[model samples]
Target: MDDQNKNLILATVLSFLVVMVWFWLFPPEEPELTDLPPVAEAADVTTPSVAAETTSTPTTTPAASETVAEAARIAIETPEFKGSLSLQGARIDDLSLTQYREELADGSPIVHLLKPVGEAEAYFATFGWASAEGIAADQVPGPDTIWSVESGDALTPETPVTLVWDNGAGHIFRTEISVDEDFMFDYVQSVENTGTSNITLRPYGLLRRHGTPADLKNFFILHEGLVRMTDGELEETDYKKIVDYDLDPREGTQAVRLEATENGWIGYTDHYWMTTLIPEQGTAFRSTSKYFDSRDLYQAEAVMALQTVAPGETTEVTTRLYAGAKEWDAIRNYENEEGVTGFLDSIDWGWFFFLTKPIFWLLHNLNVIIGNMGWSIIALTFILKALVLPLAYKSYVSMAKMKELQPEMEALKEKSGEDKQALQQGMMKLYKDNKVNPAAGCMPILLQIPIFFSLYKVIFVTIELRHAPWIGWIKDLSAPDPSSIINLFGLLPWSAPEPGSFIALIAIGIMPIVLGVSMWLQQKLNPAPTDPTQKMIFAYMPWVFMFMLGGFASGLVLYWITNNVITFIQQYTIMRSHGSKPDLFGNITSSFKKAPPAKDAPAKPKNK
Candidate 1:
């Protein structure tokens, strides 16, 4: 075989091998309920501060379900959020993201980010003082302690609400909670000591979840669990990892802690939304991830440094809570403008952060300019192809140079047919003499691998693509193309096969069909291989990929189609520029020509 065929075959086989192993190599996410580590008598949420006890535990405060009656609630209304606050612990529970819905269906309920204790998958954030230095446990409010509403009737951007708890021992605790038009909430925690003696206390903010989130996608591509940033470093701890945490000798519990001297936040992040505790930046704080193995609960804590309050003196600390959709622009603004360190990285950029970040940046800006994510993706394909044009030009030029040497290579092959080593030597000398690099043609195909994965990560993980639409039949660019050939794309009276089933694999949609066609058309740029094995492989490759990726997100399939088309155009134009115009029509026509019958073997074959 010529070096061109060898290179092309090697690239194709490598791609095929990668696709074949994709299923088992990168395992799908295990079900949340089934994958628990062995458990001990788990502890409740612990105070991340020193010598301070929780009302529920080795420290004190209830993070699990309780028989306690529902506490009085204050309505929280923001343009992007609508929920309630529980006065019991001044907890921001019962919150829903007004901007997002439970499903794409009409009239679906708004996405609930936090729920009260009684609800399934209960999650919320609470802040309180951890009593220390001679301050009794009762000297500070616990989770069960009810607070008096001291100010606004509702929590809104224009009107902040205040909740007051009196230790009645001459120390008063007040929380003034305010919200922005979007998702951030500010809490001003103030302590005033009226007694003659001073007191030591640490104010802590925590996010607690009861059991695993039932809606966990559990996909390995996305991170949906405990995500935290300490100083400038980021860490993600999944539920299973949290469950397996060893007992901490420092906190004397099943937990992990890291100190952030300057900037940090701790939180639980789901597929699209997040609920995190943001301590004041540029301050020392302890970030902890704790799991109650027995209770099947998880908690993230941001405990501030211990402070002493003198008699008649007041100490106030301001912290923030981010509880809503992880919109890229909004989060980026927090990182760049609001000084949330590495905040934008909160989005799961995967291992390809270098590529995913910039790809998302371009896609985001393109969407902003075009107002349609589908078109933006198509436009992104154009820009990407343009960026790689120089490399692609050299690759195609090398391919054309190889095509120019095909006649010489064939003559050498016939002359050295009985001497395989001589044929190989002749091919190498011919390539070197012509200054043609046989391997150059494979570079673009190899480069496409990483770009493909990075784009897939961005499309699958970013909120910007969620429910984004293009033209008809392309609603929800993040989802598979709903049109199915099995039902004649709804022109038939029956519905299409259910997605992810074997039938759906065979019943691919319009986008995947176009993808296969684009690949086939690109392949037709070169004549069909004369070798039977090579011809069979090239013939089947495109349709095989079509079926394989039929179930992928429409946006990804759209990208693949666009990429293939642009590649075909670039190869054709570059080949023409090199004075080696591809005989595209002749190639397509020749592919349809029936193969000639082989000569009959002699009787010796039958004897064997």
Candidate 2:
């Protein structure tokens, strides 16, 4: 085969392998149709901390669920959040993002980020003092301690709330909480000592989950577990990994702890949402990820160094909690404007951070300008194509030159039959004489692999694309196209088969069909290979991809379709410019014509 065909085969097989592996590793799950409870009945958000203790590892048992049920909750209302803070531990437990819903349905419940105790898979955040050298664990207010509202009745951006508890041991603990209009919660935890002796206490903030999130995607492509930044380094721990850690004898739980000097945050990151405990910047602290196997509880904690409190002295520590949608702009602001170091990395940019970051940045800005994610993706495709146009131009030009020299190369091949070395040397000389680089054509295809993977990461992991609408029938770009061929693109009365099912695997949607057609058209830009193997692979490649990618997010399929169409146009225009006009219609027509039966193999089988 000539270099052009070889390059095509390499690219085709590489892409096929990638998609096949992707299908095996993380097949899309069909979205459930049941409705989640409304905001009033939905009672959870991010994780609430496990009980505090004297040692670094938590030793105190969680208060009964009744404590959360009976504790008076302070109403938490903000522009982006709607929930309540439980007084039991001064935890911001029952919270939901007012801006997003659990599903695309009209009355779907809002996306609750944290849930109070007594709710299934309770998730919430709380900031409190862990006694290190203080009198006793009970001397400080703990999970069971009930705090009365010391100030504001409702927690709002305009009105901050304060909760106080007098330990009756000559010390009083107070937690003052405030929120921004966005998703961050600022807590100032303080303790005042009226006793004569000095006492040591370490202020800690934690996010505790009763179990793995019920809605966990559990996909390898997107992380949905403990994500923490210690010092400048980031670490992500899967639920299973956390469970597998060596047991901490003090707490009888698996725990991973690191001393974070300078800065850090610890939290659980879902696909599109996160709840993190961001200690005040410039502070030295300990970041911990712990899993209690018996309880199936996961806790992410940031505990500050112990400080001594003398008579009449007061100690205060500030920690921030981020619990809500992981909006790129908002998270970026938190890092750039709010001084959270390396906070932007929390978005799970994948190993291709170099490409994913810029791709997402361009896509996000394009979305802002165009006011539609679908068009933004198309615009992004154009922008990326333009960025790589120089390389693509060269590749196309080289392919066109190779095509022009095909007849002579074929004659050379026939003359050099059975002399492989001569054929190789002759082909090299021919390419060199024409100043054509065979390898140049593969560069763009190779470059596209990382870019394609990165864009996939951006669309799958980022909140901006969640439920983002493109056009009719593409309501959620993050989801597979709902208009299946079985339903006649929604024209038929019967419902389409559920995605991820065997039936839906074959009965794909309109977008994927369009995708397959676009690829086929792109292929028609060049004549089908004379070799039967190459011809069959090329012919089947587009349809194979269509089915494999049928269950992918509509946004990704849209990107692929746009990419294929743009590539066809670029190759066609470049070939025309290079004095080689592609007979697109003729090649497409010939593809359907019956091939002259394979010359009967010259009767070699009979002779054998």
Candidate 3:
């Protein structure tokens, strides 16, 4: 094989290896729930039971049979959210995001964030007190204890609601729930001890999901389970990992616990939504992520240090809950302004966070200014090319010199016929004299690998890219190219193969076809190799890439197309500047021409 063919094969193998390593390191999406053991109903909180001394238990006032609609509720109305809080446990459960939806189709149901406890897929956030010796389990508000609304008629951004539950033995528990225009909720739990003796209790916040969500993406790149930031460190645990945690004998559940000495938060995160408990800053708390095998329940809790309340004295603890879309700006604001440490990291930036974060940031700002994500991706490609233009220029110049030396190389080969060592020595001397580096062409390919992976990560994981449209039939940039050629770009009545399927891998799309065309055009800068094997490999490389990346996100495919076009323009200009004109049209025509037969070896009889 010639040097050009060797370089081509090396580049192709390296590119393929990089992608394979990426998939190996970060596996693809898998089923959300598999081999799920049958689960029993969660223990009802209404009846008085001996609560564990070390574990915090959330109690409610109604039986499990009661429907959410039958229970008294405090209506929640905000600029971005609309839902209700269940008065049965004063749990902030029934929430729906007014800004988002279940699908991109018109009139799709609003995205439901939380559900009441008695519902089929019970998911909700509840706050309660864990008692010590003096405070009886019944004295503390159990799940079955009914609470009456004391202050507000309804819960809104401007008007908060206060719930009051009296133990009837000189102990009163009051919960004041307030909402912001955004997704943040403030719950101030205060207790008044009217009896003579002092009582000790610990305030705790718990977020529970009875079963795994049905719509989990389950993708390796996007985390959809427990996420917590504690003492400047971020921790994320998947549902499977949490379920497999070591059993906590005291709690009788699989659990992982952390003692957060300072600032910390704990919650559950979905693909585009998250609900986290933000305990008061500067306070120490015990954080726990538990999976109750009996009920198939996933729970994250922040239990504050125990506090004592004297007779006639009232003690109050304030905690915040965040439940809404994982918008970049909103989460960043919470991180920067509200001092939620590493809140932005909760978006699953992955191992390439350094690249993914800034890449998405620039793309987001470009989209805001340009008003199109697809075009923004194109612009980003241009910017990246411009930034690396110097290196690319050197690489192209070296390639141009190599092409210029081809005639001399052919002459040397003929002169040193059958002498492999002499041919190599001559070739090395020729390259040194020309000031060309054989490895220079590999630079551009190496540089693009990380950028491509980072951009793929950004498009796949960020919520800002979710449902973001570029143009016709491309309603979601984050999703795979919807226009498949197999269906003739939707001309056929049948649909394309499902994503991640074998058929989808081979079924090329319009973007992939465009990508193949761009690559072929770029290859036209040089003539096809004379060797049949090399020629075949070069001929099929573009189509191979087309099929390989056909199932990738449309935005990434757009970037690849843009990059190829820019590279072609750059190489053509630079090669011309180096006094080597690239005959693209001539190369295309000559590719079809047959090679002349090999000449007979000169007679060796005369020398013998």
Candidate 4:
């Protein structure tokens, strides 16, 4: 079609697109599911590795194979990691290692148990080591570092695994395998060093993680805790694995590499509190030391170098791992455990921390008082609106004065229809004469944008709002509206969109119409300009706003709707005082008592 028509269509389309995108980006809240506890099984079986037949050649001797098989069996059977020794009155037994639901002193949740099946297997990739390279179920063990033990009684039976090193050099690894009650066997391995030069190795430690399939049946994804910096900023960090890593054609293995740094690092993940111990810290890179962010899974691995000692000087590294759900309070006792206690809450912070932290604190405190998150949001909006009301009042007064002088403006516009420059000059002169500020209305609205952004963060990230309720038909405020629009047969049912709750949808749908109409009416009552482009812009403002609101939060719409209703009432009052009707298209002619002369300047006559 024509350029003007095309421009109008384009504007409408652009408005519609923005609305859909905003709706998708910032929809209503939904409830989150709680983390489930680990499941109990019946019989522990010794399952074979995929490469058992091919890799078993080394440990194939009858005696060696038997020993290896037994070791594998013991490791697979126990679901919890048990240490064989004790310190003081407490004994490090299977119970200490069993999957215990304990909390750290800081009140974070944690699970203490043995290595996660998926995580243990993933660790094999560090240093290019593979589970297949170790002893497999059907494979025979050789006379190398690879060895195995079967029965539960034989595997670390009351014996603490220890590390001895001269500068922490050389490498040694041991293993055991067994199945659980459900016939699911897990493989376990321990690595140590007995050398010098601080015994720093390229491939460091392994952190066991569960496969995604296992996670689907249990566990949830949530930030383990928050971190505060010296600058008073706070950050949210996640330490729990969501979905378990997949073993087949694994996207989980993408983080299959590692790097070493001289600074030395300590890494730990918690359900909320339980943290792994570092027997001997070492700074080194392990090829399989990468973290993965898969479709539905997350896992992290960390390693560090311990203190260095000269030749003839010896040091020991001993660590115990507990795998299970977190018991926040119980783990707190570990803070005094001597080795490492304040390990789970570490998080990274950058420059933005200072700016974002107070915002979080404000939101946090607000959450406590309002109990209902939706109401909390309303409260926040009211506070912000109140703060900016002075600027809005200034804008409103300016608009009122502009309406009072519309007669003079319209006379100038009609008199200078053909002379654009003359018309502008006349308009400016009138504005100057009347001491009006044309930009007054634009300034206040501009200041409100940042507040809007802050509100978005409050609604989107606060876990307190997850599954929160707001009046009727909105069982979960955090989730999208539950109304559906699917057509099963020939009939169209009353299905709303996924994020459209009956109340919210009604509010959302109705507010915009009201907003649009109110806006149109406001425009009509205001002074009209002679510039065709200006006229066109004012004409399209209501439609543009409507489409923009289509994707806005019902709460945001509620705010706008309230603001508009108030303004409409205010404008009506202003009009009655002047003894005239409010125009629907920003025409301010009726607000005045007398028509003024055209303000456009007369052009000089041209000689032929």
Estimate TM-scores for all models: 0.90, 0.89, 0.87, 0.48
The TM-score measured for candidate 4 stands at 0.48
lDDT of 2 by residue, 135-239 (tens): 677677655568988899899999999888888989988899999999999999999998888988778887878777767776778887989898899998877
Candidate 4 segments whose C-alpha is farther than 4 A from its true place: 1-299, 308-360, 479-494, 497-544, 559-608
Per-candidate clashes, comma-separated: 8, 12, 9, 97
Query: Number of clashes in model 3?
Result: 9
What is the total number of backbone clashes in candidate 4?
97
**Local accuracy by lDDT, each model:** 0.79, 0.79, 0.78, 0.38
Q: Write the per-residue lDDT of candidate 3 for residues 316-380, one digit (tens) a residue.
A: 99999999998888889888998887889889888889988999899989988999899999999
Which candidate model has the greater lDDT, 2 or 3? 2
When summed lDDT is taken over every stretch of 10 residues in candidate 1, the lowest stretch is 598-607
Better of 3 and 4 by lDDT: 3
What lDDT does candidate 4 reach at residue 533?
A: 68
Q: What lDDT does candidate 3 reach at residue 52?
A: 47
Candidate 2's TM-score: 0.89
Q: lDDT tens digits, residues 1-608, model 4? A: 11233355446546656765565456533424343232111011111112332221111212222222222222222344433211100112122334432421245343333332222211111111222432221222112122322223433423322211111124444333332321112233334434343322211233323322222211122234212111122223333322222332322243322233321222233322223322222323211222334222233333333223334443333333433323322233333442223322231212333423454455446667877655665565556556667777766666666666655665666777888777767776776776677666454445655454454443444433444566554445444433322332114566444334334443344446666777776666554544466567768977777646644544555445555555566656656665655555444334354333333434322222
**TM-score head-to-head 3 vs 4, winner:** 3
